[model samples]
Structures are given as C-alpha cells and as structure tokens.
Target: MNDWTSGYVAEIGYTYDFFHAMTPTRMGLAALSKGVQHPFGRETFSYCELGCGQGFTANVIAAANPHIDVHAMDFNPAHIAEARALAEQGGVQNVHFYERSFADFAGSPGLPSEFDVIALHGILSWVSRDNQRLVYDFIAKHLKPGGVVYASFNTQPGWAAAMPMRRILTDHAERGTGPLEKRIDDAIAFAETLRKSGADFFANNPDQVTRLTKMRAMPRNYLAHEFFNKDWTPFHFADVAADMGQAKLDYLGAANLLDQMDELCMSKAQLEILDNECDQVRRESLRDVMLNEQFRADLFVKGGVPFTERGAVGAWFATPFALARRYSTGPVKMTWRGLEVDMAGLDYDPVLQKLSEGPATVRDLLAQGLFGAMQWADITRMMKYLVGAGFIVPCLPLDGIAERSEGCRQFNLAVCKQSEETQKLSFLASPVTGGGVAVDRMEQLFLLARSEGHETPESWALFAWQILAPQGQRLEQDGKVLETAEENIAVLQVRAQSFAARRVRILEQLGISLQPIATAQEASVASSAAA
Candidate 1:
C-alpha cells in the first residue's frame, strides 16, 4: 500500500477532478428538502467538500447559490492552487478554497462548527485507517446539528473480486520494467496467469471471468488508484452505519436513489428471511441481489437532533407560493409514474403554464403575471408542488441560471473529461431540447420576435406566435393577421393552458404528484355540484 503523504501528492489533479465532478449541490438540495437541516437556516445552508480537488463542485455550488458560503479544502497544495485558479477563471466568488489536510484542520484551533453539509466523496477508502478516524472525528466535531454528510466508498462483495486484482497489479508493477503503461500491461498479464491457475473463483464463474477481463483492460492510472493503494479497505454497509454512529452521526440515507436496496427491490419472502439476520449481513445479502455491493454514497446526520416526522417540511412548503422567473424555454413535458396529467385540469394551470419554459427563478415567475391575484401562500404551494413533482427543479442560486450549463461545458471538459453522470445532469439543465442550441441563435429568435411588436408575455412566445400565425390564418380562412392583442392573448392563453395540461400529465407519469389548485369556497362548490 502507498503511504498517505505520497498518495496525496501523486496525481493530486486526478483526485480533485474525480470529486469535483460529483455535484454536491443537487445532493445537498435533495437532502435539505427531505428534512435535513442546514447551517445558515432551514432553506439556506453552508457547505464544505472534503478533498475538494480543483474546487470544481464548490465553484458550481457557489455560482448556483451565492447565498450559501461553500468552503473547499484539500491537503495537496498543488490541487488547492489548481482549484483556486479554476474558481477565479470562472469568476465564482462565494467559495473559499483552503490548502490544508483533514488532520491539520481537525487539530487546529479556531475552526467553527459552521458547515451544514460536508461531502467526502471517494476519500475514506483511499486514506489510511488513522486518517479515516480523523475524518470521522472532524465530522463529529464540526458538522452542525441536523447537518448531512455525503460519504462514498468501496465496499465488500465488489471488493472480493477487486482485492486480488489489486494485489496482482501491485506485485507485477514492482517487478516490471519501463514506463507506467508498460508496467500496467505486465500487471494485466499476471491477472491472466491467475485465471489460468485453475482457481475455482475464476474457473467456475464465466461472469467473473468476463469482469476480470474488463478490469484488466482499464488504464494504468485506474489500476494504480484502485489496486496499488496501500490502505484500500472495502466496508460493509452495517459496519459503516455502526461506525458512523460511533462518530456521533446517524445514517440518514443513500445518495443514489436507485440504489436504496430496500424492501421495494426485494421480494417479501426474501425480506422476511433476512428479517432475523444482523443488519450488516442483511445488507450483504441484499447486495447479492442488487449486484451493487462495491460503490455506495452514504448520507449521515449528526445524532441528538430530534427527528421530525417525514414530509413535515414538504407539507409546509406545499402551499401556493410565488417565485421569480429563472430561465426561458418552450413547452416542457412532465411525467409521473408513467401517467400524464393535464396541468390545465388542475387549479394551478395559469402558474404551471408560465413555468413551462426553461429554468426560471421563483421571483421572476411571480412578477410575470403567472400568479395574478393569487395569495402569497397559494403561490408558495404551487412552487412547492412544481418542485415536489419535479416539474421545476430547484436551482439554489437566486439568479436561476444553472451553474453547470453548456456555458461552463468547455471549462469542465478542459479540467475533467465528460462523465456519464455529469452529462446527464447537464442535459437536464440545458436550454435547447437536445445537446444544446446556440445561445446567440436563441437570442436572435427572441430579438426578431420582439421587433414584430407581438403583445406576448415573453419574446419567445411572440416568436412562436409569428411562426404559427400563417397556419392560424389558413385554419381561420382569413388572410388578415390576428391583429387584436386581446385575440392573441386569448389564443395564447388556450395554447398555454393546453401545453400546461399535457406537461402536467407527463409529470404525473414520471412520479410527480401535484396538488389540485382550488380555493376553499370554489372546492366546496365543485364538490357540492359533483355530489
């Protein structure tokens, strides 16, 4: 195993890039919305990313939520220098980058328990056991009450295959000559030699054989990071939970929603059989079915904070509410659980209609007549409904622009090659329907529409009207353009309503449940009529 100091110094850039690419903003928001407390306030929060390489994730969060002060730290000075440079280049001001190791910071005086969210992605498994203890101690001492910590690590079952591979590579590299690449080739050759040794683990399982073959083909850097490390210890889930408890933290949840590995994915019979088993062993058995015993993102919260009922905060935010507009786009489709809902059919049609465009701040949305005459509480409810149903993703930044859009694509790619996870989130926040539409071209369309003097809420809407006018005329049998503002507004209203309805349906199919919009009196009257 490699020493901690050398591992920290060697290829610090790669380590920084790996953690920086894991966006903690979305994870932080989800955890907060799910009842996690933040340091600043319930809605606002402070955060820090341990081992924050090049400060990429910190920069994005700082750009997204200027209100949230994000601190990024790494033991490696080179990594810190690169992160600071990246932050400056991006003009991100809210993040404070520090070049200090975890042990130094933990032992140093004057550190505050100021961070509401602490993220240690891919750090624990790589560090020495003593360093891991230091990390846990820091979390216990510094994390604010109700705060959440995001820690990811390698685990068993997955490591069962990975451990031997690592040993083989490390031994081979020690004996081989030439560069890292050539040594890696020699290491792979050793893995093949092991497979031919007639071992039951490799011979009996074709799936394992195929997996080993793929692992052998990975780059030397990957092999070094995975197998050559001196302190590479894979953990069991229950043991992890117990270890967290020992550190004055409680297991909150997992970062990957898909990897919950709960009763939902297990048959009732299987769950019943495991009911009597110990928590650690039970998780091991479940991982056997899930086939994901290797990598995990575990969320933990400080203990002693009173546990409130789940969904309490959600219910409070679900009342009708108003927020600013954040971005511009065309009609959007939202689905929930494979069912479509008509947003127009709901009482909040007018509001949802206004938000169908690309991302928009809550304040902007309200200012644009979407919540016309609606109570402030009602507007809050509507916004919460949209957020809960995933119609409008919560962007923490007051400006509503995605911090990690194509605008930053070049910078991100320059610093770190595109990964599947980063690509997917970027697509979700993109302005254009597919990949990305050029910003200048989109602006040109808006300008052209504005020059036409169409009385629409947004320039994009006017552009759509201009393109659709000829078709509308042909359908109406009148060569005359729809000249009346009221006529255009009425037509746009219907179109907007229809668009909202379709989007609502789609959102429902995607598992987002929106509340029916209605006042107390109106709901009573409708119910009476139905009865």
Candidate 2:
C-alpha cells in the first residue's frame, strides 16, 4: 500500500484568508514602483495559482477582475470541492478549480496553454524538493513571455533558531498513533514537559520558550500544516533566485510595497552596503540578512521589460489613488516589525487633506498646487510610504469598472450570506482597487442587513442579534463576554453606527452598493403596478 498525501497534511485544512498581494493589480503596482514594466495592461489575461489551498484568493481575484480568467489547483479534493461550491454559490464566472498535483497540472490538457501570472503563497518551503522542481518545470513550460510569477517561502537565517523545535515536533508526531490532531497536541505537550523539566535547549534559548507560549495560542490546524509537515526547508534568497532563474524568471521585487522602502527596514550603513552591490541576487541576499527576514513574498518576471527612469516616474505620478479608510485629519502612525513609527513630522497632512475630498493622481494634486514647496522626490516618497502603510491604495482603471463592480457585488453578497455560518471569510471583493478589503464578520452581517432593507443602524443591530442569539453567541468587550441579549444588541448597535459613519463611505467609493437587489416577484409586482 502507498500513502497518497506525499507527507503533507490532509486531515486538516488551510485558513480561508484572502491575500491581497497575490492579486494582479497589487503586483503590477509593486513592479511599477520598482521601475519595472508588467503585463497587466493587456486587455485580457490568464492567471493560475499552484497549490491553491481552498482557493479563497483566486475566487476573490476573479470576482474583482471579471476581465481576467483564473485557474487554481490543489491536491486535496475537499479543498477543491469547497472552492467550487463557493464559486457556484456566488454566481462567479471565469474561474476554474482543479484537484491536481504539481506534476499532474504541468501535463494537464484542459488548462489554458499559457498564463500571464502564476502565483503561489507559502508553498515552496513546505513541499518536498521533487514537488518544488515540478512547480519550476510548470512555470518554464507554460508561463507566457513578459509574465509574472509570485512565490513566497520561509527564509533561512530567521528560522535557524526555530528549526530544532520544528524537527522535534515532527519526529514526535510521526511516532505517535491515532488521529493526527491528537498526535500534534501530544507532541506539543511533550515539548512543554521538556521545557518544564529544565531542558538545556529551552534554558539556553529563552526566545524559543516565548515562541512556544505564542504557539500554544495559535490554531491547531495552522500548526499541523505549518510545522508538522515532513518536508519543511527554509532557503537563502540567492538559492531561490537561482531556482527561479532555471525557469528564465528574474527577480522583480517584493510583492509587499512596504518591503521596497529600505529606510523603513534598514540602517544607513546597511543601505550603503546594499546600494554598492551590483548584482540583484547578491543585494537581495544581503537585504534579507540585514532585516533577518523570516518569510518573503517575492515577484519574478519572465523576460521583464525595464522602464526608463522618466517613464517610470511619469507613469507612477499619473496613476490615480484613493483613500482606503475614513477621511481623518491627524498624524498617521504605522507599526512595522514590532516598532511603531510616528509620521507626525512628515508633510503628509496636506496630501491627506486633499485626498479627503476624493481620489486623485499626483499630477492632479500638483495641478491643484497641493504640493506647494515640496519637491517631486519628497512627494513620491510620501506617496510610497502612505500606500505601503495601507492608508491609501491605487484605483483600478475605469475601462472595466462597471463589469468589475457587478461581479464583486455578487461575490460579496455570497460572502455576507456565508458569514452567518462561518467567520473565516473576513474579506470582500472591491472593484475600485481590484483587490480584497478586510471586512470582519460583524461588519459583514451589518452589510447583509442593510442589503435586506434594514435602513437604520438600530435595525441592523437587531437583525444581527437575531442571528447570533440562535447560535448562543454574544459580543465581547475588553475580554469579557456580554451574555445578555440587550447587552449584545447595544454593543452591536454601537458598532453598526461606526460602520455606517466610516466604512459605508469607503465602500461606496469602491463601487460597492448598499441598496437591496429586488427579487423577481417584487420586480414583477412593481411592473404590474406601473402598467
């Protein structure tokens, strides 16, 4: 007999969170920020995700960008089934899910002949070396020219201290019997027992003890797939670059906009050293060392076209952007890598004030004289930091906004309906940004209520309470549970009011509708009355 999982976790499932970085619009923006030309301007393109667990991001991207065709595959039939069910329920078109391995997908006859973008997140370091090679081969064979590939993995130096802990857990779990979940719990308990017994490994590395404490609080499903896998290997940036080179893919940039800004993560001396490095691979390696990067979400392009300095700057300034959050006037602070950086002294107040009115490009701002005495370089840096910190986002091109809006509304409505049963789907498709927006379960319930003709926040709160009361769920305040029905409704009403005051405006600008969709019966009655 032979095992079919190939040493991967199959008893549990991956989380259903959406990754905005994997979306094409975000990838193109990151590439353009680095002065590289991407293929996103094409009228229509194909996208593929390898090892797409549950296919949440793929579904959201397809919904947000109706012009793009999406294909996603996973080896687990359960994952593929759930993905297909969600797509069907949402009435989403232009997306196809498959239950195929990396090797099988490379030779599959039913897939598109070529893809403009191939993306996989946190997949490389978790799979066996043979499977990783199959992924590379697939990209080499099917990725279109001038295409982009997004791959994320665990990095080496940052994981050096945690490697032994992972090995101990894997070894213990492999030796145990019965359900995999129980074995995982036993292995963690055993490690905790060792620590309590004054093991030298734990005594010498106090940080590992702290990490173990945090791990005790994390989801067991996440732990099972993340650490219990038989093949978990963290690689150096240079090695991964070489692997990508095998497929004729060149390192584009970090999928994260924040990672592109060196001052945020590096010191002056470190920056000087990195700036002096001529080779792209070597510089990226040194950068990882400087930041002690644990994981990386990187973009690579096949036969990339470099934009001239003038063209890059011109294109960036010409792109329109909108505020992602409520219009506020104050010093904006951001937390990165456990450090909170204050932007009070930065001259972003003027720009923020201008954007409060509506979406506009840098050129538009300049034409309005909002820059005053600031240089173009300073304005560019400000925009980069602001966008990277999530205060603002680039808007999608207006050419297909109507189509995107229709698809995203249907997908978001399906997600809102599903929120009653599960809170795992915490994002909604946005047509304006062409990406997913973080909208929590409670907010989703409120939105659904509004779409069902609940006019006021008070009514929205009552609708949500009715749903939660049956499930025996209550609101939590400062770690204390509000058990009474009145208490829950009060808290929910407060939240609904806040949502209506802030999130509603943002959603409207993103082309999301809060009005109800009339049923067929209602429409026919209205038609008869008119006649």
Candidate 3:
C-alpha cells in the first residue's frame, strides 16, 4: 500500500450500510432536547460527512430531504466509486461524493465555506495524530457559527480492558504478507490460542476472552480497520472535549439518544460513583468508569446560543417523528450500563398510542388532550427515552418530503431491488422517518414478493425460503438454528403473516404513504386503515 494510509487497511472496502443514528434530523433532535442551537430545523442547509465509507447515509439523506446539500468523502477511492455509482443508480442528484484525504479537504478552496453540520463517525480514534489535527482544523474553518459536529469514537475505561489485545492483533497482522482477511483471521486465532495457553497476559487481561470471542463474529473488513489501524487511541471525555475546544466548539450533548436519559442509563448505585467529582467534565469522566462505555457518539457545537426552556418546549413540540414500528412501547424495561431501568410508572402509553394513530409532533399529542396531566419536562423525558430506544424516529417536514417525492420513491425502489440480492444493505432510507429503517434479508424478500403480486403471507414465506434454502442457511428460532427446509419454512410462515400485515404496510407508509402535514385526526384515520 501507499504511504498515505500509514499502515491503515485500504485493500478491503467498508460495509455498504447506513447508520440511522448519524442522520441530521436525529442530531437536530439531540441538540433541541438540550436547548442548543441547530440548523437542521431550518428551511435549507448544507451537510458534510468525514470518512463517509460507501456514502449510504449521505445519499439517503439527500434523496429524502431535497432541501439539504449533501457532501461526503472517504479516503478510499473504491468506496467513493461505489458510493457515487449507487447515487447515480438511485437517481440522487443533490449528493456529491469525493475521494479525498483529510489534508487535501482541509486546504481545498473549492469545498463549501460553511456547513450546517459535519459528522465524523468512528474516524476520530482510528487515524494518525497529524490527521486528527487536520480534522480539527477542517471543522474550525468550515463549520458554520451555529453548526453541530457529530463525532463518534471508542472511549476509555471500557476499552482499557481490551487495549492490550488490540495492540497484539495489530502487531501480528502487520508482520504477515497474506491477504488482509487471512491476516486478521490468523491473528485472532493466535490470540485465542494465547488465551487457552493460560498466558500471564490473559490472566492480567481477563476481558480479552470475551473481547476475542465477540471480535471473531465481526466482519473482517471491520476488524481490519478497527484493530489494525496504525493509530488507535481511545480517549477520555474530557480530552476529546478539549480537542474540540481547539475548534471553538462546545460539548453539546450525546447524539446517541439513550445517553441523554440519565435515569435510564445510570443506576442510583452507579450514580454514587461520581459523588466526589463535582466538575461537569470530571463527573462525565468518572461516569465513564461507572458505565464502562467502550464507545461514544457525541455532538459538539460551534458558538451554540442557548435557548430558553420555553423555546425548547416549542421546538420539541414542533419537531415531528413517526412511531418507528420497530419496538413495542408499553412500559420501557431497558438495561443500560448494567442498570435495568423500567418506566412503567411513566405512562408513555398515551403518547405512543397517539403516534400509533399516525405521524404527529409532540404538540399534536398534547393538543389532543393526551398527556394532559404531565408537564412538558415529564413528557419530553419519556419521549426522549422512547426515541432513544428506536421506538420513535424523527421525520422531515411536509414540504421537504413533498418536494423530494420522486427522488425518494425511486431511491427506495432501487434499494429494495438491491436488498433482494444481498444483505449488505440492511437499512432503507425512510422519508417519513427522515432516517434509515432496519430491513433484514427475509423482510426484503417479502417486500420484493409483495411487489411481485405475492400478496399472501404464505407466498412471501415460500419466496424467502427459496432464497435461504439455496444457500444452505436455516431459520434461527429459540436458541438453535433449524436446518431442514420444512423447519425453516414453518417458522418463516408464522413470521410472514405478521410481516405482511404490519411490516409491509409500514414499508409502504415509510416509503411515502404518511404525509407530513396530515392532521392528527386524518392521521388517526390513516392509522386505522393501516392496522
């Protein structure tokens, strides 16, 4: 490889995937929840993504939101080539893909001067120190005054356990001349041998056993980039915040929704761990120790003007989201950072019940006399928890979705067509949700079958089994993998019935069925028809 990579893996291209959490609307919601300024709620905006491998999210955002100017780049030309081709195939015109290094992008006069948002996901901790500084300089120069930077990276305390193993893997892989995948495979196998050999390193780093086990299941390309990167630095919250500070940015809040809810994430017992740390930064650092957070997805803002509590309430109410149809939200029983927190007492049922009626804003639910007793804070808190859990999703405004109508439809059709062939693309861009939706391989087959006039669930089951049986793959049920065609088809039959009734309708609704400006009453009627 060239000196440009500096031992970074470039031979293997990244996964063709979309991260829904990296959406601009989601970033806007997180900022709004904290009363920080954001540009995504505006009429028009420009967004950029650094290290946007395969550029799936950027292309989807541009297709779904006609108003946003999307620019994305990756150092790998192969990834950018595939990304650009996909955009062309999908007929997405607004998004532009570039294959450029950090230094070149930072100094380029041709790029946009200011951006509404800049996202760097899983790149900060995986690059050289010089490249990291160039990233900081890029943000400092190009981010608009009120822009938010969504940067996610591996973090300390949780990663401290596996740091030694990461070094061992990288060192072993670099010494070999084999294909990248084989090198990664052999390195992992060697690590397992070391673990079984009762080495003193394993005794000292007991977490390596679990890490190695889980690491084996990950894709080779993912492992190559993660562990084999020349520069892999897991940071502390305070240190990363300081790095952003050099760009005149402030730590806004977490882009990951669940991190926003303290009550759900931290137990009372775990909360006690921060008793001695009074400073905000120190408290956050100590909390990482309590939570053992291996990775962090954070948001920072440049010149963020704080909004009043009243302003935050109005923003929260006006922002729209559809019930994502992915989760059953009655009483929330979720365990985070070893804390099993249940919100059964919080009556989110009424709010969720209203959304099940149709896509509506927070204000819409309150105006209907639902959550009549709860104050804004109480309601917003529960909504935050719901949104974090993927039970709800942020949606584009009526005009935005309407203007991008054809672009959105064509893109989804192309994606669904591609999904029928490969499981690489597990998510579809949803104009209704203003983000990606998880659609597994079988579900994708079902959608294809439905469009092909296989309207019944049994037909969908047969179609999916045909795809699975040819590969010798079986249905996974209970804790075991079922091997027979009969066993697989039987399970797929039950799944298809529910999928056809609920999921197909949702697939249609997300593609374009649910209009943004429809009144709550109108949404209620539409909701009944869907059910």
Specify the poorest-scoring 10-residue window by lDDT in model 2. 520-529
Candidate 3 per-residue lDDT over residues 1-531, each given as its tens digit? 788776567988877778766887888888988888789888889889999988888888888877788889898898899889888888888888888999887555457888989998899898988888989999999999999999999999889878788888888888977898998998999899888889898888767777789999999878777788778999998999998999999888888778877666666876676665668677778778877888989899999998887888778888877777744455656666666776666777777777775688877887888787886678878787877766777777666555566676667667777755577777767777667777777777776665555646787789888877777677788889998888899999888777755675455556542223333235334333533
Q: What is the C-alpha RMSD of each candidate to the true structure, in Å?
A: 14.1, 4.4, 3.7
**Could you say which candidate leads in TM-score?**
2
| Candidate 3 Cα misplacement greater than 4 A, ranges | 107-110, 267-278, 326-330, 464-491, 512-531
Candidate 2, which segments miss by more than 4 Å at Cα? 342-346, 514-531
Error of 2 at 518 (Å): 11
Ranked candidates, highest lDDT first: 2, 3, 1
- Tens digits of per-residue lDDT, candidate 1, 1-531, equal 134463442441343233322344335433544455434233456787887755555665565454566787877677678778766654556678887777787543444466777888788888877888888888877788777788888887766765665776677876878765677677777778888988776766666678668876665555666666556778877677777887778766556432332443555776766665656435454654445467877677785243265443443333222222222343433443234422332355555555443344455655677667876545544454454344444433323223333233323232222221122112111211101111222222222332234223243345545554654431121455566655765555454443333322332221111112222224223323322
Most accurate candidate by lDDT: 2
* 1 against 2, candidate with superior lDDT: 2
Compare candidates 1 and 3 on TM-score and give the better one. 3
Better of 2 and 3 by lDDT: 2
lDDT (tens digit, per residue) of candidate 2 on 1-531: 026678889988988989878977788889988788887766789999998998999999898888888999999899999999999987788899989988787666679989999999999999999999999999999999899999999997888888988888889989999888889889889899989999999999898999888888888888988898878989999999999999999999999988988877677999999999999999988888887888999999999999998888787777778888875777778898777765544578777777776778888888888777887767777777888888888877778876787788888899899999889899899888888899999989987887776667788789999999999888899999999998999999899888777777676666665343334234223323322
* Candidate 2, pairs of clashing residues: none
